[model samples]
Target: MDKEITIYDIAKGVGFSPTTVSRALNDHPAVNKKTKQRIYDIAAQMGYRSNLFASNLRRQHTNTIGVIVPILNSNFQSSVMAGMEKVANEAGYNLIISQSLGTMEKEIANAKTMYNSRVDGLLVSLSHDSESIEHFEPFFKKGIPVIFYDRVAEHKQSTSIVIDNVQAAYKATTHLIEQGCRNIVHITGNLKINVYTDRLKGFKYALVDNDLPYKKASVIATDLTEEAGIKAAEQILKMDPRPDGIFVANDFCAVNCMKALKQAGIAIPDDIAVVGFNNDPITRVVEPNLTTIDYPGYEMGEVAARNLTNYLDALSDVNITNTVTLRSDLIVRESSLKKKLKK
Candidate 1:
């Protein structure tokens, strides 16, 4: 086996002190640019790969950020993770990502793992059953930064990144109403989650503003799964006066609901218009091109990661900014356009 190269080897080869070699490799500002470059050149020639574990231990920093999300399979979450990976890689930071499977117990377990790993910082999107922020206390007590994105919760010591769910949901519901939908149904996830609850508030506000009655039955809270969408469609069909439109919180669920409705002899838009959030690709492929909110998942991830890294580097303080809200816009499509276009 080839012998592992160390900073001492590079120092000897470059005729410099081992400390200087270490500083140069770590890109410390104290190291002169020219000397750092020379050290890197020599280190490469010597096959001197960094001992990140030992380096991190000495600095009390892992050079690693931990990411905890509800799930990893969804298109929106995947896009967010991709964005995070891009930013982390460019910044020379590694990421340890974990999924909670939408359960609080798993989320707590993931948090414990991250704490034990000695990550420099953490980025989290709360799980469906995550009711308390106490799971992150260890990070807080240790002064480690924690940033929340998407499905987030309020924590006095942490920063949160999110899109305007209330405004987006309002716009979606309002659009449906403008398209001649009087009795529109809202399909969403658990109300305990801030995203779903905020959207529900927006949906109700839109109804109240338009002088329409907010029927409790019109709001269907489900797991926002594909199967839930089909069940929601079935329930809607059984209503005394069928819903003329649907505003589903997730594009996946909305698309599935639309498919089920179509199978039940319903003509989309003409019979029941639909609007969804996240603007997943399925929205475009579905017949009638489902109208949706273009959620900035990737952008949100990038911003969250950049902010956390900046804080970790002591470049800025994230606590001053409690919340960072990104932009979201509705994309009009045939799925929810009930008004006929003028020829």
Candidate 2:
């Protein structure tokens, strides 16, 4: 293997002191622009890479933010991550991302790893089963800022970024009601998570507002997977009086459920209407299009990242801002539009 180039080698080759070379490499204000450019040129030519480990030791900051998310395969999560990366990179900070795979144990392990890595800040979207935020006590003790987004928790000292899940869900359910769906079923993920629970609340509230009976049997709790959606459709088919509407907590699951219902000879928006959360691309591609809530994952990610970096740069205080709720709205489509639109 070739020898790794060092700042010392760049200093020797450029005829500058190691201190001067180091300052120039770091873009220290004391170093003139010409000196910095010359040092950069020599370092690039010599294949010299700045040692982040050593630099972090000197500065007592990793300049890296750790992000823990539930899953990575979904479009919503991918968009969020993209937004986070753009802001973090522009702010001269790197991101260390990990997935919990929707388990508390994995989430705890990821939190421990982030703590040990000494990340300057942390951004987390809690797992489906994370019962407590005790794992983050180390970061709290060290005064390292932690911001939670999406599936967030209640931490008096930390900030949470979320959408009004209850309100979004209310709008979806109310739209179904307006379309003449009285027997509505809500397919949701585990109610243990705030997102699912809040959505459930909205579903019930909409039922009450419409003077419809809220049936506990109508609320089906699943893992919100495609397979679960199929199973939910099967269950819906077997109901004594078939549900006229379904409000799924996720787009992927809702699309699968729609497919399942179609295969079972059920007509969408005619026999049973469907609505989903997260305006994923699949919603548009699906047959008859899907009615969904536009959960702004990308904007949420940008806001979360900006909030963390602002605190790190001493431009804002997390304590002053408890929760940042982003805007969300309903996008009505063929799947939920049973009533004729008046021209």
What TM-score would each prediction reach against the true structure?
Answer: 0.82, 0.82
Scanning candidate 1 in windows of ten residues, the lowest lDDT window is: 50-59
After superposing candidate 2 on the true structure, give the runs of residues whose Cα lies further than 4 Å from its correct spot: 1-59, 317-321, 341-343
lDDT of 1 by residue, 1-343 (tens): 8998988888899999999998777655578999999998888788775643333443478799999999999999999999999999988899999999999988987887677667899999999988898989978877788999998988788889999899999999999999999999999999999999999999999999999999899999999899999999999999978889999999999999999999999999989999999999899999989999999889998999999988888788535349999999999999998897321
The residue-level lDDT of candidate 2 at 202 comes to: 98
What is the TM-score (0 to 1) of candidate 1?
A: 0.82
Q: Least accurate stretch of 10 residues (summed lDDT) in model 2?
A: 50-59
In model 2, pairs of residues that clash are none
lDDT of 1: 0.90
